[model samples]
Target chain A: MTLTDESPPMVNQAPSVPATQTVTLTVNGTAVELQLAPWTSLLDALREYMQLTGTKKGCDHGQCGACTVLVNGKRINSCLTLAIMQEGNSITTIEGLAQPEGLLPIQQAFIDHDAFQCGYCTPGQICSAVGLMNEGHAKTTDDIRELMSGNICRCGAYTNIVDAIQAVMHPQPDKL
Target chain B: MINFDYTRADGVTSAVRDRASELTAKFIAGGTNLIDLMKENVERPTRLIDINRLPLATITETEGGGLRLGALMTNADTAYDKQVSKRYPLLSQAILAGASAQLRNMATDGGNLMQRTRCYYFYDVATPCNKREPGSGCSAINGFNRIHAILGTEAGTPDRSIHCIATHPSDMCVALAALEAVVRVTGPDGDRTIPFAEFHRLPGNTPHIDNTLKDDELITAIDLPANGFSKNYAYLKLRDRTSYAFALVSVAAALEMEDGRITDARIALGG
Candidate 1:
């Protein structure tokens, strides 16, 4: 019932020196190498090591999805994952959701629907929305609510956020 | 937070070997629990051995007509897996009902089993929590103990001591208990298997102790037997909120009925 990753022991002793581990991962189509501590989270590594600050850190704990990212095409809370675990994996962040010239459909829809305010949780919200739209697990509002409940918006933008995602998923002819 | 050293382990063998020699070493996989504990200074490990890169992420079939779930399989993967959904629906539904989509995607099968309780007293260093500091006085016995355990209590134990009776916090484990899963552990000595019932120990008198895992031991995999009766199982979770919240009371039930007569029943509860 309990799910766990198969990682070796990383935290039973005190080390005399800081251990640096090398990791190679593809983020948003860019290959990057990072020298990180074994315990450094993917969120911390992305924000500190790679300097991709679009992924926000809300609860540090797994309760908030402000640090949501895509690993091997699956959405996950980056805060809960260690950077070392993502080696050789493909990662997609908020930065990867669009091209250099314009926004992705989800991002554009959020803009068109005015889906945010203060925007602290926007990056994570958009990322989670993208994952949900592509998940094929959600077919109704109930499913969407269940799937997107992890990403919380303090601005109370749930209505607009859901509307934006729905528009992208079920596009109207006039809107298109 | 204190500064600590870190090591990236290539596989489980090297990680366990390292832990056998280093007393301060601990395994770091999904940081869902370990990182939070470290940041709170509840668990201070100087050296963290990274085992996330090991080849243990797949869920495969065991030789004994059972399912072997790799230690690194994430909660989301297991919950949505076709095999798990068909054979062990309770396990799948329980995993989905507990954490949010994002957390489930990152939380691993092993880390979910190893998660500590969310006792407020245990987290508050200012208060006396035996689970946080063994032998320390308990403060929740007469305090806010509505969430404390009612089934397992030791006689002659002080009211304050009973504060540590918080039940196992994971919904996934509740289903595992009902499914009668087996945990496979790899240690310096060798590999060993423990039934799920014995895997998670009740607080009893020593509420501070969670499980029976040794210092250098690592959970390598979890194997679930083919219980034909489990096909008719279901997981029911009741929580304060509709989503992204822990369970208030959850039930994993497997019922076998012969023409409306209760032939067999397996049930596990978590609150």
Candidate 2:
């Protein structure tokens, strides 16, 4: 009648491994846990740890927009933000812009219009463009130029980049 | 890059007060300017105190009818805030005009105010710069002097001297200067306010010291005065490129005219 032998054995485990300063952040709609150094920039964390190398690191000085990303739906220079500073924040990198199966509408538009050349700055350009679309301050091409000015394309494909962005908002009948 | 100790402080008090006695400490908000400087060895703090998590990210209405901008509020937030857009249009416009959307989103008001000048000599360790090292001699005086200041320089002084002229870096602060903004600082003693004009110091005799802030002091907030001029202000920046480039010369103006005669005009220039 005694169930002592059937009961599971309780193992006294060694002290649980000290929990790392795990940052729980939502990246591209999926929650992720990352242990990062306090001084590791969000750009370095994304590129080095998460392997999201799409976000380039041209200047790493905040002078170049090659590392632009959306934190909580707002475009920010990832190089300027520390990873620990974004512990509970929502992050969206260039890799997150597209749908599961195919490219997002903006990516498609960039492709159709040949918005990039050499493609070094494409990820930042696309991410910045997405942010620009939601920004209320940009009204015209001039405004777009001013707003998009931060993301530098050494290829000098700005005219096409602007064209690609405009093509999405005002679809051309001829192109369609 | 050299490795250093990193500490994250929960609040302003701990960040400034609990500094290691033997080590130099820096309070980093937005790494926009600091990181670059660190990499270049311009700022070699033995310990970095991360203050980004502090509860200082609000743009509120002051009791005296002005705006109180929290130190931790990002530049983009202040620029896009509805109240800031409507009331201090100059500030909003200036903020938008300086950096790109991405940089602005990461840059905080406190860090923006503390940004160093874009002086080439200052950034180049090989070059002589009094601001970088006192008595190093100025290279810009004999070298590339095109971007150097002309308005504030004194006669007979070294052309590259920090005194009389060193470019005031912030587009936001330039607007604040014209709008007569007040900077609120929280020190070991308590909270205090300094006028915008007095907040930044001209190099004069000591080009090494930039602002009036003490080592233990932290800028808590910036309060913009409520005045008729603020409602009608505007900002114009002239830069080399259409985008991300720094200003060659910029102007922030708030003018009130009655019958075509200037009733009041507030102007702050940046070069």
Candidate 3:
């Protein structure tokens, strides 16, 4: 649900603007605190409040996967969940994927296969791929395609995206 | 969505008490559908009772050799659970065939049953929808009605007293209907159980009421029968897209075969 902290009991009718509550969220690797209204979504908290623009907002209604992020290592539409409800949970965004040394395997693989053309849905695609691997469900190419159907590339980059994810999922041995 | 006060319910008793006290306060579990409705102005709850922290997310075996699915259990977990997939594969397949991986991860079992109809007129406040506002008028009755209900309507009657074309948009309920599961709910008054077949009501005169659930009642769990249709079963969903789309027409069939002969069968259809 959209995030909103509860206020003290009102003796009279509730006011138009409810009181903003303090919500602590563990984003990427840091614990950031913010005063958010009850209607603030986690996606809005990340992009607007925390300045983590790496996570894009495609369809805020959960129809598109562009707003996806890992909540406790499981991918979910951040736009649908309220920031206040995720207090005790650990959230991972696209910015947290790569190590300090280099890019993540899926991120690098995307570049190698030219997985994205517009790059609008790339962050969500990469995060979803990481979640898919953790889930350990995808086996065949069809499985990957089916599981990754939520992330849509309007530029028609399905073939390359599938290739990139498959390459990361099943890496080939280097030749001598 | 407008600003609403939120409270995290500690237990089922407190949750029910809170709901019973307030008429406009809604319980927020997954918020997958509730938030969408709130954004569209279809639902305007002044206060929201967050029940995500409730201790009802477990799946336990019943004394009758059945399975009891906790109301707060995520659809993804229930579908992928070893006991569920091994014993009730039809349910697992049906849950997987409905929504995307992300939605299944957030949507809870109880919330899945509470999904509103996807009828365009119902969501649009401008249109005249009887389900939205009774006696206003049914927009789908005469307007573009491709996704409306085919049955449970009497268009040719002399005087149309009972008429609503909206349909409940859920794929999991179809399998539950075929399996004859039981819905356990707790209300301010007490606890009760409702049969799956009698849970959802047709769009009769009162189309606004979707199910038989009381205003203050909370679904605690869903009890599955011993016969889970683990074998000799099939779930087919015909949708516009192969994945991440609602079903146009779906069917769930389970058969009991004795020595290659069909002894019994259960079948249910959904749209």
Candidate 4:
């Protein structure tokens, strides 16, 4: 392994493919075990295998937060992380955002404030908003907008989305 | 994405040894950049040595009155960390200005330094890119290169043969350059420290060589010196949109002001 400038790199030396991989996760309060390819992304695993179709896959890249999910309480792009990498962790998707009895506060706020038009990016928006509020960063309306910029609302429903989030963060006297 | 063998590294030693043993073996933490490029087929690793489980996610105060950030610390966590926000607000601001809330949550500290250029030619396999393929000609030199480099490329002479002109699209690295951060890496031989400026190389004749790090080296931490940059500093990023857009050009400036006497300054630019 001489690293001199003269030697050509040994990148294409071998055909390195692995067998099927397995990963277990506490997804949406359920201990779900999945077998998948090593290259399978968390987004694909959630939507395709686990059938958690609520987490939409828009860009299939990290650019759009359509596949945003909370991994161990932190919001991350599910498309960016490999499914096998998240072995000993918990995953919370938009489908799991709702409580057993009823809708979560953020979900209720989105409904009350009319936060969706076509409702395509709503799941990602709600999930990311939940994580954002848990992060405890956004204070004012501008803060909410700035922090929520990751979840892109393609239908131009950003104004109502901000209203929905702001209402939850600082509830009105009677609205509460 | 191509199929690849995967192994979770036991520790730093094993990680370095595995990477040193195979040239195509890659250390994956956060998997934000590596997996993205793999999806695009821009980079194909034979084996991925997952380093996420490594105990490298602490942000501790160094004895030298500065912060030593763990390599695996996410950009969002580092930006909002109390120590980073208070002592090195410039770094926090820069990280915040680069990626969105979700991307920052996924992108790691060392991964930010390792992310490749957003050059279209490099991403597109059909085009001829010297950076992507060593002997191939650069298409961006003759084609649409509005978002390319302006400073390091032969200073406005499009007449000469341009090797490669793609710019590093990192806002965190820009701030790291201004802060004069030191990158701590552990390789097969031993541990070595690389200065931030020398870490990223200009796309000169050898446009393929992205950075100065050895292929076997694994970045463990970033050490910041005694920060005289807490008071007067700014990270201004000019971009297409307000958020979720790569910067067209960005500037990170830190000034040391003792009673408004204009003592010292550090400035770095990026795109």
Candidate maximizing TM-score: 4
Put down candidate 2 lDDT per residue, B76-184, tens digits, no spaces. 9998898898888889889988877888878899889999888888888887777777666677766786676766565564533442245767889889899888999
Residue by residue across B1-271, what tens digits does model 3's lDDT show? Answer: 6678899999999999998898678899999988888888777787899999999999999999999999999999999999999999999999999778888889999999988888889899898887777666788888887766655456665423344688777889889988889999999889999999989877666777788998799999999999997889998988888998887888889998999999889999888
| lDDT at residue A39 of model 4 (Cα atoms) | 87
Ranking by lDDT: 3, 4, 1, 2
lDDT of 4 by residue, B64-116 (tens): 98889999999999999998998899999999887778888888999999999
Candidate 2 residues lying further than 4 Å off, grouped into runs, are: A1-26, A31-36, A171-176, B19-23, B154-165, B228-232
lDDT for B66 (candidate 3): 99
A86-169 per-residue lDDT for model 4 (tens digits): 888889998887778899888999999999998889999998988888788887888888888888887888999998888787
Query: Which candidate has the highest lDDT of all?
Result: 3
**lDDT at A12, model 3:** 40
Question: If the candidates were sorted by their TM-score against the true structure, best first, what order would they fall in?
Answer: 4, 3, 1, 2
lDDT of 4 at A103: 93
What lDDT does candidate 3 reach at residue A144? 92
Pick by lDDT: 1 or 3, better one: 3
Worst 10 residues of 2 chain B by lDDT: B157-166
State every prediction's TM-score relative to the real structure: 0.88, 0.88, 0.94, 0.94
Per-residue CA lDDT of model 1 for A105-143, tens digit only, reads 889889999999989899999989877766667777788
Candidate 3 lDDT score at position B104: 89
- For model 2, what is the alpha-carbon lDDT of residue A74? 78
Weakest ten-residue segment in model 4 chain B by summed lDDT:
B152-161
Could you list the iRMS of every candidate?
9.0, 23.3, 10.6, 5.2
Query: Global lDDT of each model?
Result: 0.80, 0.79, 0.86, 0.86
